[model samples]
Structures are given as structure tokens and as C-alpha cells.
Target: MLQILNEEGEVVNEKAMPDLSDDELKELMRRMVYTRIWDQRALSLNRQGRLGFYAPVAGQEASMLASEFAMEDEDWLLPSYRDIPQLVFHGLPLTKAFLYSRGHFMGGQIPEGVNALMPQIIIAAQCTQCAGIALGLKKRGKKNVAFTYFGDGATSQGDFYEGLNFAGAYQAPAVFISQNNRFAISVPVEKQTASKTLAQKSVAAGIRGIQVDGMDPLAVYAATKEARENAVNGEGPTLIETLTYRYGPHTTAGDDPTRYRTEELDNEWEKKDPLIRFRKFLENKGLWSKEEEEKTVEQAKDDIKAALKEADNTPKQKVTDLIKIMSETLPYNLQEQLEEYTEKESK
Candidate 1:
């Protein structure tokens, strides 16, 4: 495992820093702040019954943003449900993300100019998709690559190995990020698999694998940037195991984590919070301060408020339209079903 930064706001290795400028560093902090605010808003919206399903990323900003910021705009991203923050940074609009939480059809569609697929809902299903897409990009001789995110739990799924095997066999330009937040919903990571480290799983496939301190954004960024460089250089895929945690319920469906986790455990991870560590690092460099953080928070609040109003203004999807968009030409059964539903609803 590689740990460039420690828990107490100190850098352990200044020599292994990633190629990020001071402006970029400040931007990263701003993004993490904005993303944390957005996470809170989404959770509140879910509680108020104003939004549908949501996966909070409150405590995983460093893990998510650092790796995501490492990618170029042209690179591919295959995200999971909890990865909406990275997706937004990669070109997804905040409003669309809000719409996604509302379960609106438009929210699921990949808008123009974005190179990401809809966040995978079926766990590791995106792994194979990442492999398949990477193969296509390789065959086309494109410099771009594809990377996907899954949790420690997804490593146990069949698709996870299959994707790794396929990419390794052909040396496809792909990257796999396993956000080891220590739990796959109710199941703790210890019970999920026998592997001592998730990154070593890539060894079996003959690809590179590395572990990083997910709480330290700089380490994650450096690892991801190196993985991407290696992959695009035709060295094939790399698997990154990010050691982080989720601060709240896995989803807003009322899964009380206390059933399987202890409050002591949460408090322990709290001591190593990503935001505080990064803020300390930046402040030491004269790149950030408490006053700047407050201003950023206020700006984020206004921006989120405007986004909420925009999402509210967006028209709701009708059942008839939903069924019609199911296909270019609705199949006979679907057409019948659509007509029946439309007629029933008209009454």
C-alpha cells in the first residue's frame, strides 16, 4: 500500500507528488467542498421526500475527486450509483444529477459531450462494459481509455474477474477502481471476500495493481495519473484499491447501518476525515484558509439552491412518453402495454 499523506495533516513523501499546480490544488479543494455540500443537500432532499434513491458520498470526496481529477476530459468514465460527484466533475451537470436522484428518465440518459455511461445500478456490471469499451478504443487506435468504479463487494462478483481477464488477455486500455469503503451495503468487507487486498486481484489477470490511501487525495491522484499513463501507453489495465469509508447509510432507502456497524467504527474513520486533512495541507501551503473555505461553502450553497430550483422547474416525465422511448419503434407488446396504461391513466 502507498500512503503519501498521513492522517494528521502531514505529507509523508513530498518527492512523490503528482503534477498538480497550486491553482489546480485550490480547484480540487473547491470541488471537494462543493461536492460535500451537494451530498448533504441530496441527503436532505431524500429525507424530505423530494428526491428518489441516493447514495451519499459525503466522506469519500478525496477518494472520488482525486482519482477523477486525474483523468482528462476525453477519457472514459463508467461510474456506479455513488459516483455521481465524479461524473459531474467529468461533465455531468449538477441539475442532471439532481434529476437522477429524482428518478427522472432524462437524468439517466447520457447527455451530449459527456463520455460516461449512466451510473451502473447492478453492482459490478460496469466492469465488463469497461473492458468492452476499452477494447473498442484500443482497436480504433484511440489514445483515450476507459475506467470504472465499483466497491469492495463488487470484487466478489463474476463480472469483476471476467472483465479483468478479458482486458488482460488482450491488454486492453482499461482501469478498474475499487472504492473499498469497508462495506458493501450491510455486508462488511471481511465477510465479502478472502483476498487480503483487493488490488492484488489484478495480479491474477497479469495487470498492474496498486493500493493508495484513499483518504489522501494526492496519493489517489498520483496513482490514477500513473495508471492512466501506463494504460494509454499500451501497458494495459491497472486496478486501484482506494481505502476509504462512507459516513452515512449506503443508500437513502432507510438501511440503518447501526445494525451491522458500530458507532465507534464511524467515529474512528471520522478522525481521518479527507476534507480536514486536505484543508490542512493546503493551508500550510498558503493555498487555503478557513475564511476561503467559508466563502466557497456560501457559493456552493447558492449554486445548489439554484440547481434545486432548476430541477424543480424541469417537467415530470409521463408514463406514455416513458414507454414510447423504450424503443425507436415500440414492439407490439410494448405498444399494447403503453396504450393500455395510457388509457387507464386517462380515466
Candidate 2:
């Protein structure tokens, strides 16, 4: 696996280190801290019954944020349900993210200039969509790429292969990232597939494939940066498998990871926590301090509070509102239902 920083936060592969400026490195750290804070707060909100349908993102910050850090604002991002951090960082409003988890229809609408789709709830579906988007960019002579993310479990789905095959055949400018957190909810990686490495699956699609230590933000950033470059250069797509872990349950909807995960295994992965190691690295370089980190934490909390308030202030969606957006001229059945709901709501 590709790795720059080891578990102790020491650079093990100096040659593979990304050539990022100190300020850029600091920005990446700040974003990771903010994302982690947001993830924690979202989970709390879910527990408090303020937010619905949340997937905890405590341990996958490097895999999510670092890869996104490598992308340009113009590139298209096709994210899976677990990738809200990437979407928000890509310019989707945080309030929209909250609304989405709350199942509000307005959350689905992408603001102009934000090149992203709402998080795909269906497994592996975004793979095909990303392929199509990449092909469109190529046909239009755009220099941008389409970047999509999915879990290791998604590789077993038919759409994954179909998407890669189509993108490879068309030489579409795309990058597909698989965050192999070792379990598809409760199923272990060993049970998911007998394949030695998830990255090797790309060979069948005739694309470049590589594995990276997902806990190492620098490594994740480097791999994604190169993948994006290859894509924009018309070299076709790449499949990147990030070896990571999720410290929390699969979702806030009553998943008990303890039934499948052992204390030993969890402890092992905890030693490699992305935030701890990355913080150590920055501190060693005289780039980060406890004071700065505390400030960032406070800032994130305040921002999340504001975003949640905005989400709370949004007008509650009505059935008629959904019907109106479904079509400019509704079908007869929908029209009748809309009128019924509208009239009932009026009362």
C-alpha cells in the first residue's frame, strides 16, 4: 500500500510526500478538523432526533477530505451517501446537507456552479453516472474530470463493473475512489470478496489502479492528485482503494458494529487515527499548534450551529410542493393528489 506518513506520524516515504506549501497543508488539516467536528455534531443531532439518517464519519476523514482536497472546483463530484463532507467542501451549502439528511426535497437541488450531484443513496449507482459525466466533459472539450467515491462493498454490485467498463472503453476522464473501510455494514472484507486487493479489480477494466493507506492524508492526497492529472490528460480513469476504518457504527439507524468488530481490531486501527497523526506531523513542522486547533474546533462548532439553525428555519415541505417540482405540468393522477393535499393543508 502507498503510504507517506506512518502510524506514528513520521514520514516513512519521503519521496512520495506531496509537494504542498505549508499554508496548503494547514488548510487541509483545518478542513479535516472541521469535517470531523461536523461528523460528531451530526451524529449527536441524529441521537437527539434533530437529524435523520446519519452515517458517522469519524475515522474516514483522510479518505474523504484529502481526496477532495486534490480536486478542482470545476470537476464533477459524484459522491455516495457517506460522502457529505466532500459535497459541503465542494460548495454545497451545509444547510442543504442537513436538509438532505432530514429528507427535504429542496436538498436535492444543486445550486448553480456547484458541479456535484446529491449523495447517491443507491449503492454503486453513482459509478455509472460518473462515467457518463466524464464522457460528457470529454466530448465538450472540457479540461475537468469526474470524480466519484464508493465503498468496497459497492465493488460487488453490477453497476460498478458496468461503469468502469464503459468509462474505460470511452477513455473517459474520471477517477473512482473506493474507501475500503473493511466492512459493508456488518460483512467483513474477507467475506465481501476473495480478491487479494480491491485495486486490482480495475485491471479487468483496463485502467490504472493503486492502493493507498487511507489513514495517511498525505498519501491519499497524492494518489488522488495523480489520478486527477491522468484523467485530465486523457489517460482514462483510475481505481484507488483506500485502506481505512470507520470507528463508529455504519449509521445512526441502529447498526451494532461490536457484533462484528473486536476490541483488538478497533484498538489497532485507533492507533492510526488520521487526525492524531496528521496533527503530530504538522506540529513537528512548526505549522500547527494546540491553540490553532482549539480555535478551529470552536469555529467549526459555531458554523455547524448556524447551519443547523438555517436548516431548522427552512419551510417544512408539503406534499403539494413535491408534486409541483416533480413536473411543470403534472400528470392527471399527481394533479388530483396535489389538489387534495393542497386543499387539506389549507384546512
Candidate 3:
């Protein structure tokens, strides 16, 4: 129910909004624009056969950007494959993100000082990992909290319930963020569950549940900030359902959304695009202008181009490197198989 800006981008409730400085507001807008540009470039790269695959965070930029900004530096982030924006917002380098998209093993390495896990491809697996990380931090007497990102469809998985239950029972410091994009690939929310709202599912887990207008950056930031504070205070886990949407197909080289969604729906959602909406709000505050917007977009595009070029220029991963980095001591059968493959390749 908390809203700072209305659909038209007018400040409807400024009194309840955070007193974000002009510079911070502009930075948020810039990041959202950058994320949009990066997503488009990645999708195009996938289409041109340059990258393996991509998940476009076209409409959910505000949700990711704001939630990430709400976290402390030492907080842990357990993200899914579709959370590239969240990672990027947390200062993850664009070059490394490009490396990840290009399937480089080096991309899996977490940068120093970043408490982020490699993006999990398996659906809902990061939830359990987040819970475990929170428990470990608690036992060590660390004040850091874990923030886990997943989709609404993942709520149906057993891991989701188990993770929340365990976090609550042990009073682990964690926050579960469900990006309820209204669809799990081709399956709609109605087909996934009869629960009136995804937030309601958290009730039985003995955690605080809240829903937010994900398109509004302020709302996402406020909710996450509150949840994060609770976790650090040992109030246990909180579940946040971010009501957002993916404006494009689930992923590049994946299913077609046109077959399931009409152009009308897409257009309607486009009207509510988070980047555009937030920009309008900034403009209304006399903090943003068309010229500044153009500059930001151009800079973001240049950065993406540079990242793609860097990704392309990186040395191709040697097949042997995979085997070398495997288990320290391979099993007898696997070692034999690896030796045979190496011998054949040497020919």
C-alpha cells in the first residue's frame, strides 16, 4: 500500500517517501537506464549468436536496483540466473557479467569484498543455500544478513518452503525476495498456485510477509530496507513479493512469449515501464532532463559495447582447464575416461 509515485509519475505521497538526495535519485535513474541498455544488448548478442543465452530484465529494473541499494556491503546475495541487474547494481563489473553470459569459468569467481554467490541455474536451489548462509552467519555471530532472490514459480518448489521454515525456526537473518513476474516461463501464476497472493504463502512459515509495487523504486527500496533491518536485529526472516513483470521473453533462445501473450498486454506494460516512470518522477522534481537522460543512455551503450568487445577478446576457455579444476583426486573410472579423451584430442 506504500506508494511514492503514481502511475503517471506524479509524487502522490512524498511525506511517506525516503528523503533521497538529488544525486542519489539521479544515480538510481542512471542505473535503471543502464540495466535496460545492458539487457537489450545482451539479448541482441544472443540473437546474433555471440552469447549463449540471456534473461532480459526489461521491466523489473526498479525492483532489482532498489533492493540491491537497500543492502549493506557485507550482506550476502543469493541470486538466480535472471538477477543480473541485481548483481550489476551491487557494483559487479559489466565485463564480468559479459564473461558470465559467454560461459567463462572465471565469471563464476566472486569478486573480492562482494558477498555474492554465482547465479544458480537450477530453479529455486538458491533458497536453501541462502538459508544455510544465514544460519552460518548467525552461528558465527556475524551481523550480516542474506538476501535471496527467486521467482514466483519457485514458491511451489519444496526447497522454498523448507528454506523459509528453517530460517524462521532458527531465527536466521535472511530476507526472501520473490520477483513475482506473474509467470514462470510459460506457466501463469494462476496455474502455479491458488494462493490469492504469493506473500500469503509466507504466513505458515512464521515470517513477516509484505507485497510492494515493484515498478516503483522507492517502494522496493523501502520494503527491503525494513526487512533488512529486521533481519540484522534478529527478528528472523521476511518474505517480500515484488509485483513486477518481464517485458520480453523469459530468456533468449527460449520459448516465445508472443504465442502466450498478446501485443496489447505488452504495450500496456510498456506504458508502465519502470525506467520511464522513474525518469518522469525525477523530471518532476527538477532533477532530471532530456539532455541528461540522453547522455546516460549513450554512456551505458558505450559501456555495453566495450564489455561485449572485452568478452569477445578474452582467450577461449581450454577444455583441459575444466578437467584440471575438477576434483583434486578423480575417481579411477573418471580418470581413465579423462585420460582417453585427452589422448584423442592430442591426435
Predicted model with the maximum lDDT: 2
The residue pairs that clash in candidate 3, if any, are: none
The true-structure Cα RMSD of candidate 1 reads 1.2
Number of the top TM-score candidate: 2
What are the C-alpha RMSDs, in order, of all predicted structures? 1.2, 0.7, 1.6
For residues 1-347, write the lDDT of model 2, one tens digit per residue. Answer: 99999988899999998989999999999999998999889988998999999888899999999999999999999999899999999999999999999999988898999999999989999999999999999999999999999999999999999999999999999999999999978899889899999999999999999999999999999999999999999999999999999999998889999999999999999999999999999999999999999999999999999999999999999988899999888999999998899999999
lDDT of 3 by residue, 305-338 (tens): 8877887888887666667668798888768878
* Estimated TM-score for each candidate: 0.97, 0.99, 0.95
When 1 and 2 are scored with TM-score, the better candidate is: 2
Once superposed on the true structure, which residue ranges of model 1 sit more than 4 Å away at CA? 344-347
Between candidates 2 and 3, the one scoring higher on lDDT is 2
lDDT of 2 at 65: 96
Give the runs in model 3 whose Cα sits over 4 Å from its true position.
Answer: 345-347
Worst 10 residues of 3 by lDDT: 317-326
